[model samples]
Target: MCVYVVDDDPRICRLLARLVGLEGFEVHTFEKAAMFLENLTRLKFGHVILDIDMPEHNGLDVLDHILHQKPYWPVIIISGSTAMDDAITAFRRGAIHFLRKPFRRDDLRAVLSEARKVGVKRIAAYELQARVMQVKLTGRETQVLDAMAGGLQSKMIAWKLGLSIRTVDMHRSNILAKLSARNSSQAVAIARGLGLTQ
Candidate 1:
């Protein structure tokens, strides 16, 4: 499951994300409501925790905009306000829950768990459509690549594959030479673009 937090306060955003992450949800933090909204269509966050008091855009306004774009997006609104009117306004504006500021970890965890239960159906379906790109390699070189992908050094790969380290290095050189990659990260990215890890 994924969780998104949008707050003008970067510290709060980071803290909340870390808390959610501890609950086993993948977390993404955005300092501005506008930036998060820009990626709303392309990004599928399981649950969104929004701050109502952001400088540029109010949380309810952002939520309304998101709903206008995608009616059923799940969200929770957070605020320091204790006014019943604010909570009512949040619900009327389509917030899933109203979380007061300085919420307890257990409460957040429970909310996140509930969000995942609801969001997993969609996340699972999307995961099937998602692809992880891997590097290109021949049958033999693929073995080498997979090992390297695991962070095994050349000597370790060679030992695992019953080959000399020099042989492994030669294969690595050939692989890099063919792919025109400056390093492993670049190679992995290029391979992804070409759809190698389907």
Candidate 2:
């Protein structure tokens, strides 16, 4: 598998490339988001190790762009700061993990393992998408499901979609039932696999 490491610091990029390369994976390092985006089309399949703080465009913006193009893409956000808000926001933005800088090698390994599992899940989701489209969801339910896949809470979804909280809750329930998902996260996963997020 290939791994794309995006960080402003060349030293950090080299460290990650070396560490990941040692694992028998092809590693590519980028010092800027534009460079990364330029080369992204060449990377058919891979996990991204993205640093959150970068000049020109922040990590979140990059992440947003990536997800817009590929919702099921596996991205792990890394930063020097341990801000809880940032971590939460990353998760809400569909990051697999938010790792702090200077992380232990074992931690990196663990995160990579988790990302691999997510990759597997994404493949399965793609397969399931074909079947999922058979289920009929109303326009609003589809909209709500799309929002849920974006990691938005019911309240936020309601506000964004200009619906009542009760309506959002109802749509969430219907979406979960239709998708056979136990919760919002699973529903979102299924939605992502179905290519419904874009």
Candidate 3:
């Protein structure tokens, strides 16, 4: 995976590039938050190491933009500020980890390891969501599938949906065929796996 470092300090950026590179990740450095945001669409799957203090745009603003555009991307904050509020705000804004400036190599490594695992899960979830989107289901079929996932029988689902039992059964059969599942249980399982049902 790639590691994108956003810090205004050239020395710090170079140090982070070298350090992260040694860990076998491709490294990209940006001196400004605007540059990072502008190039976001071109970036590969990766985590970000961002410094809180920078000219033009601060880390928190950039963090907000990142989360807005790509909610699953992991962002690690590196700041010299010791203010507890900054750390709290960072976490509240969905930062994966916050490291104080002059942070130890071991601490960065640990967070990067954690971020890698998180990144993998996020990617898998995105892929599953994409696959789920490709499977077209009618509104009523979706309702039936959701009711099935909730462990509702055909009679119960029909009553809840204000539909006849035969209509509910037809929807169930269509859902099973569309999902390529043999039974209601298997259909529910597949729907959950594809993120179509909770």
User: Which digits, one per residue and each the tens of the lDDT, describe model 3 over residues 46-87?
Assistant: 999999888778789999998888888899999999999999
Error of 2 at 198 (Å): 27
Pairs with steric clashes in candidate 3? none
* Residue-level lDDT tens digits of model 2 in 1-198: 878999999999999999888877799899998999877766678889999888777899899888877777799999998789989999999899989988998899988988888987986776577576687889999899878777789899989999999999999999889888999888888777666665
Return the TM-score for each candidate structure: 0.59, 0.64, 0.77
lDDT of 1 by residue, 98-176 (tens): 8898899888887777666656665554443343323336877767766766778998999999999999988877667
Which residue runs of candidate 1 sit more than 4 Å off their true CA positions?
120-198
Lowest summed lDDT across 10 adjacent residues in model 2 is found at 124-133
Task: Report lDDT (CA) for all predictions.
Answer: 0.77, 0.87, 0.91
lDDT of 2: 0.87
Model 2: which residue pairs collide? none
